[model samples]
Target: MDKHLTPGHVICLINPVTVNLSHNILVINCGSSSLKFAVIDPESTQVLIQGIAERLNSPDALLKVQPLGSQAIPYINHAKAMAAILASLGDIPIAGIGHRVVHGGEFFSASVLLNEDAVAKIDACRALAPLHNPAHVTGIRAAMENFPELPHVAVFDTAFHQTMPPHAYFYALPYDLYKTHQVRRYGFHGTSHRFVAEQAATLLDKPFTELQIITAHLGNGCSACAIKNGQSMDTTMGLTPLEGLAMGTRSGDVDPNLIQFLVEQTGRDIRQVTDLLNRDSGLLGLSGLSNDMRTLLEAADNGHSRAELAIDVFCYRLAKGILGLAAALDRIDALIFTGGIGENSAPIRARTLAHLKVLKPTLDHDLNSAHGRHTAGRITTTDSALTALVVPTNEELVIARETQRLLQP
Candidate 1:
C-alpha cells in the first residue's frame, strides 16, 4: 500500500496492486420504468458492455443491447427486466454486482456490502424515497436471486451528501418532525456530484480536498451540490429529487403554501396537486413545449415566447441555486456543469453563467459553444476569477469503483 494525501490533506492508503486485477463488475441502475446495466472493469474503469430494458411492464417493452441491436422483449417488471438483462450478458464472468440505491436514509453514510440486514435498512428508507427506493429494492432482490453467489454492493445516491452539516441538511421545520420522522434534507445525485468533483480536481491539477466546487447536474432530474474538500457541504435537492433546481418536469423549491392554494382554487385533491408539481411542471409546464432543453432552445430561437421564458426561468433558477450553495464555501474554486443538459446545452450554460457576472466568471465563447461531450476541462478563461468547467459524469464508474473497494482485501 502506498500512502497518499487526499485533497482534504487526509492520509490514506492506496492499494496500487489492485490495478492489475481483472475483475468485471456489473453496475445496475433501476428506474420506475427502466433498468440500465453495465459490465465494467473496475481496474481500468472501462465499460465493456452496457444496455437498457425500457418501458417495462407495458406493451412497448423493449430490451436494447449495445454492439448488438434493439429488440422487443417481455419485461413485465423489474424482476423480469433483471432476468432479461442477465440473459443478455450470456456467459460473461462477473466478479461482483453494484446496485445504485437511491436513498440510504441515515443508516448508511457510505457504500456497503449488501446483505439481509442491509436490505432491511434499505427497505426502511423506501418511504424517504417513495419514487425510487421501492424500484431499487425490486431490482436488488431480483439481482440477488439471479446471482446468489456474487458479492453485491449497494452504492447510494444520497451517500455522498451524508457529509453535509446539520445546518445545511435540516429544514426549518418543527424539531419533533425531524426527530420523529427524519423530515430533513438528504441530497440526491450524490454519485454524479462526487464523480464530477473528482474529475474537476484532476483537470485543475489540484487536490480534491483543497477545492471548493459547485456542481450543477442538469438533466431530466437536476440538482446543484456544494463540495468542499472532496466532501459535500451543501446541495440543492432536499428530502427528495423534487426539491432541487427547476428540472425537466419537477417544480423545484416552490412555496409550501402553493399546494394548498392550488387545491383550494381548483378543488383538486392533494395527490393531484403533488402529481402536478412532480410531473406536469418545470420546463414542460412553463414552456407548454417539450421537457427537453434542446427542444426549448430551438423553440426560443424560433421566436416562441413561452419557450424563451421557460429557458430564462431555468437558467435563472439554476444560477440562483449555484450562488446560494456558494454561501456554504469560504471561496469558490470552480463551477462545474454536467449531466445531459449541463454538458450539451451551450446556450443554457451561457445563459446561466450570464447571471453570475458579479462573480467575474469569464467564459471562453468558443469553448462554451463547443460540445465537450465526454471530455473534462475548463470552459472559462485562464484569468477569470472563477473557473467554469464541463465535465461528463460517470456514476456507473463510481459504483464499480466502490464495489471494487469493498470486495478487495
Candidate 2:
C-alpha cells in the first residue's frame, strides 16, 4: 500500500462483515439517465457498497442499491442520487472520488485530478460527447458539493487513446477541419481497452511497455484497440462511437453519405437520421429482434435467419477488426478479448477465431469451452504464433486505481 493510506476512517461493508479499516475511493459513472456509484477499497479492491439510481429526474426514478440486502427507493434526481449513495456508505472512509468522463476530446491525454481548470476543460468538450459529458459534469459537481473536501479525479474514456498517432486518427478531410474543429477519431471505451491490455501484459509475464496488443471490448458499445509500448497506436471507434463495430443499437461504420440519403428517402431531418443510426440500428436493426448477443445466439441456434446474420456479421467484423489492428504493430504479442460478450460467449469467441485461420491459431477446445476464465486465460494452443486471451475488464477498478495514484502525496 502507498504511504498516503492512513487509518482515516473505519469501513463498514455490512453490519457483520468487516474489512481492514482504510480510506476508500468512491467511483461514479453518471450516464444520461442513470448513475452508478461504488465505494471501493483502493488497496484491497473490495467493493463495500454499490448502487444505481436509474430514471433520474423523473417521478418513476428509483435508487437500486446492491448486496447488503439489495433494495430500491425513490431518488428522483442526480444530485439526490449522489447524496443517497454517500449517505448509504455511512462510515466508509472515502479518501477521494473518481468520476468517469466519456470524452476528453484532445484536451486530456490521461486521468486528471479535477480542479476548476480541469472541470472547465471537460465542460468545453461537452459538444464532443453531448449525451454523456453533461451528465458527468452534473455528477462531478454534485459529488463535489456533497463531499466538499475530498479530492476528485476525472478518468476519461478517451484519455488513454489520446496517444494515437496522427495518421491513425486523421480522416480524409480538410486538415483545417482538424485544426479548427478538432475533427478526428477519438476512440471510446479506452479505459476498458487499456485495462485489459495491462492485464494481458501481466498474463503474458511481460512488462506492459514491452508488449504489442490488440484489445477488443465487446459489450453494448464495442471498440478494438491496438496498443504498442503501453500506448494506443490505433483504435476502431472514431470521432463519435458510431464509427466502429456494430454495437447493441448503434450502426457502426456506415457510409458518410448515408445520413443524407436516409433523410432524403424517409423525409426525416438529420437529427432523426442520426438517432436512427445511433439508437435503432446495429444488432437490433440487423436481427429485428433483441440487440443482445446472447439473445441472438439462442435465436440463431433455433434457426432465426436474421439472428444468424447478425451474429455472423458481428463475428466477421470482429475478426476483420482484430486483423486490421495488427497493421499498427511491428509484431503481435497477444489478442485480448474483454467486456460482456467477449468474456462470456464461448461460441462467439470460437466462431471469431475460426475466421482468423491465417494466424494459424489452434484453438484449445477445452480451454475455449471453459471460456478462458482461469489463470492461464489462453484459448489458443501452445503451438499458435498468435495467442488469444480473455481478460475480463474492470473499468471501475482502473478508475479507482487512477484516483488513488493521483491522490498520493
Model 1 deviation from the true structure expressed as Cα RMSD, one decimal place: 6.8
Per-candidate RMSD vs. true structure?
A: 6.8, 4.9
Q: How does each model score on lDDT?
A: 0.87, 0.85
**Candidate 2 worst ten-residue window by lDDT:** 1-10
List the lowest-lDDT window of 10 residues for candidate 1: 1-10
Per-residue lDDT of model 2, residues 78-181, tens digit only: 88888887777776788899999999999999999999899999999888888999999999999999999899999999998899998999999999999998
**Which regions in candidate 2 have their CA more than 4 angstroms from the true location?**
1-20, 69-75
> lDDT (0-100) at residue 9 of candidate 1?
19
C-alpha lDDT (0 to 100) for residue 165 of candidate 2: 90
lDDT of 2: 0.85
